[model samples]
Target: MLSFSRTRSPGRNTSPLAGGMDYLEPKRKSNVLGRLILIVSLTALCITMLKNAPSFTSPTSFSRSQEGVTHVLVTGGAGYIGSHAALRLLKDSYRVTIVDNLSRGNLGAVKVLQGLFPEAGRLQFIYADLGDAKAVILHIPKILLYEVDKIFSENAFDAVMHFAAVAYVGESTLDPLKYYHNITSNTLVVLEAVARHKVKKFIYSSTCATYGEPDKMPIVEVTPQVPINPYGKAKKMAEDMILDFSKNSDMAVMILRYFNVIGSDPEGRLGEAPKPELREHGRISGACFDAARGVIPGLQVKGTDYKTGDGTCVRDYIDVTDLVDAHVKALEKAKPRNVGIYNVGTGKGRSVKEFVEACKKATGVDIQVDFLPRRPGDYAEVYSDPAKILRDLNWSARFTNLQESLEVAWKWQKSHPHGYASS
Candidate 1:
């Protein structure tokens, strides 16, 4: 599966496009003519949105002294990483509101939220479109007002975590503008929404793709970021806007650059589940299903001849549990700087071949590995230097290696083979 981490195209993205859902890439790439169509489509979609709910100008206002429990709204909270993050926030006594359009989120994984907290409804599941700024406006309480124009000035928000983005490398390569607009423009919307609400804190889910292929071995936080793909461009754009917002608007922020996130929540609840990519065989029955759906050729093994020991691409594969822990720690470690960057990974790199061998051993099934040429926007060997996060936040990875990650991954995939659709 093409990792959703924003990867830029160095002119061409060889990875599968359009969420990599098989061969459906033609309609996604837009020309000047296609832009006209997209404008019309967006306009029509906006009209339909008006029918979904009443118009609301802004968010509701609370007294400056209101000391109620801090509310954390996580957009895209139903996503793979966001799901775990939301659960962690809830457990740590932060009230969470999850807003996802279900375009990429599973309703079953969402149900897990309710299961975790019978008052799951407290974690709002807003079905509003981010593309429709007015629709996004309607979801907020009528208190949040526009900051500059005072058009919608009655709003106030404590914190917002923006995780919603079109995170596909190959898709961005084919339709770079689509990725840029969807991610960068909508991110502008999200930040504007937060700024309007006078949000105190913001967390952004970012990726390592911004670094592209750096000249160094270990990528540090301060490494020069020159993302080669549109997905990376979009993230870099958002990151820049966020920093600008913090300077101009006093928004405290954390940009988490996630490495390869593997494993599922242990209870066999959630894992790396995309709607289209399903594996008909082995642990990635979900990925195999995508093969059936023709989104991907069965088990594509990208290049395996780097200077690494295994001769395959080596990457840091962090477990979901440890990944979630970093987020939790970030909440408490908010510095006066108000904006920080952290690379969240295990720091230990593993190869594709090694990963497959481990999976085969854990699941007790010999999986297929159709080696293919190196996909576009893929780094040969990249790992994290997690020293800063550990030293600063005292957050060390608990789940040490790939086996622990895969054990949970296999269990979760087995239980929810069809993903949230199973429930």
Candidate 2:
């Protein structure tokens, strides 16, 4: 037999057990209802606050004025090209938010950028991967979706300079999936986020490899894209996707196809310091620096049998600063619903022997080299027309002279012997 409670509340007409149950049930219900109401009210309050808050990219009075200033989001801003771009943006007085996961980029580079601009609002860093949609959304504050006029008036981002990609030709050849996933898929995610935020302008760091083993010299923007390797294929895929996205949207895009990027910040504030694992010295200048500095035993010339002037591969090496200057010009000229494709290179080519001589002259030390047979996927010669970019953006590579560019790079390499390492 179950025992019933004899104690009861002071009720006029109710059984003792029933009265006891009635006393406790209302209190439990009230507690739950109160909690539910509190939760809903808090959520509403947060949403309201977020809706009314000032723009994340807005400037304080002491900071750079918000007038005519563009806030730029630079993905992969800790890597070599990305870092240089970020530095340029900061120097040009654009409010910049750098989003990098530091997976392939260097945290030390981010620190260098932060050190350059100790100001609070001019520069910001967000450590997040482009692939993680949720984390990226959480870390990079979205520009409130609004009309173009309102976006400019509200001082939100006017553009996105996307440089986040896994960009090694040899490595991509070995691990194609990783390149496709990081370069193509991650780029799609970035495009989606940019679209969601209503940022109209996009500057893509494309590569000239899209025109792999071209039929002729001086490849143009209209050159047929028949990429030879996975790296080039991934970049070409991204370019196609970006173009496809533009067909239906109001996004203005500038796709800068680079031949080769070399040199560093002329001011010596930034340079190429690839992650320790990459162990990448400068492409040719960097190799010379490493050899001269004795970082490696010596440099090796991969192939000398190509049908070039010196029987070595010839590439158009563009100074990184000049490349970024084009980006700045592109940002200014990018009109909504317009797409611009330009080859960001000097209309010239440098052979391996020529680059070696330039490096030697720049460093004042002869770099020992060993000639080897042609490596697979090696192109005989590749250069850019650059006439289209010159006409459109009024942009041209200023550091076309190989020796002058090498000299600037040599200075940077000599100073940063360990490549961001204290040694």
Candidate 3:
């Protein structure tokens, strides 16, 4: 499993042929042929764009404003992290509209969230795919538009917290194109929608995998991003695009690069429960949950030959509640023309054996483990230097005591043995 808190090509700004053309200028007495070729290429490109202009300029509208509540859109709000963030938003008196296609998210998660705030009237769900522009537009209320302009002025969205994407690193590695389509391409669609609507605040759900395998123990925001997998690569591409979009627009963006996020919501209202059959098998906590329920034969601990103290991979695990707190604070701090990037973690490291032990303590069940060879792309150790976020957002991990987190997770697993189907 690749750690989350999930790449630049060289010479991207200058054309590859520009320098070569200049170098050959002295040798070539006449350059008229080159100039003609350039002109022909530009003319053809313009004609093609003109022919496809209408498809790019689809009309879409969305609007929702109440007297006393701040409106927000949380994509993928039925999933693990998104659901927690949405619940926090509603608790904080913000009116939230959750948009998820429910491909990976469970309707039961949304139902559980709604149950938490039955009287608040602050949460709503829209089932739509982020990758489909028309699907997203149809769900929003129509109140404004422009002909042939991909403007989102009618949506009236104050901020958008995007978390809708395929997050499995193994799958990403197996099919890089799928990761690109799900993570990068979908992000562009959301960006276009956000930019069109003049939505100023954007909180991106990024991963620590963007840091790849850094040489340093605690990675800072300034660390070099050398992603080793397609999942991280896809996220890095989205982060770059978001930063580029913020440069010319009024949008304020915050890229929250998360470390290993484990545990359920402390209150037991929500937890990490991906559909069992389609669940990504890389998460240690999820593996423990399955073992506790006999969902799998037992847990498999991959890689026990690392340079760490326990000769196993080490990661900083932050509670989902604390992770969502950082999001809420980032939303409050967002202002026009401002862009911020922060690492979200507990600033500590725990080995695979240690985590498994904690899970055993939490569930009071014997967890069988089979030591296996290192999985490809598994780093020896990784954590965070979260001083920046603590200093900037006045936030720190409060529910990060590993045992406490595991206990809560056990409760969720016990209560919903089949993950919402148990409801």
User: How many steric overlaps are in each model, in order?
Assistant: 33, 1, 12
Give the CA lDDT, 0 to 100, for residue 6 in model 2. Answer: 51
TM-score of 3: 0.80
Cα lDDT of model 1 by residue, 1-423, tens digit: 676675555444456555643333444554656899989999999878875653333333221213666677787888887888888887786767677777776667678887877763245555544564454468953322232213213223467777877676766777788777668887887778776667778888899888887888688899899998788988999899888868866667889898877777776656667755423212333343334334455566768777779778888887878888887777666754477799988888888888777766666665666886876766787788899888888887888767667766777666665667766
Which stretches in model 1 have alpha-carbon errors above 4 Å? 1-68, 132-156, 277-298
The per-model lDDT (C-alpha) reads: 0.70, 0.81, 0.82
Rank by TM-score, highest first.
2, 3, 1
Per-model TM-score, in order, reads 0.75, 0.82, 0.80
The runs of at least 3 residues in candidate 3 whose Cα sits more than 4 Å from the true structure, single-residue gaps closed, are 1-62, 66-68, 118-121, 132-155, 280-282
Between candidates 1 and 2, the one scoring higher on TM-score is 2
Weakest 10 consecutive residues of candidate 3 by summed lDDT: 142-151
Q: What is the lDDT of residue 49 in candidate 1?
A: 82
Best by TM-score: 2
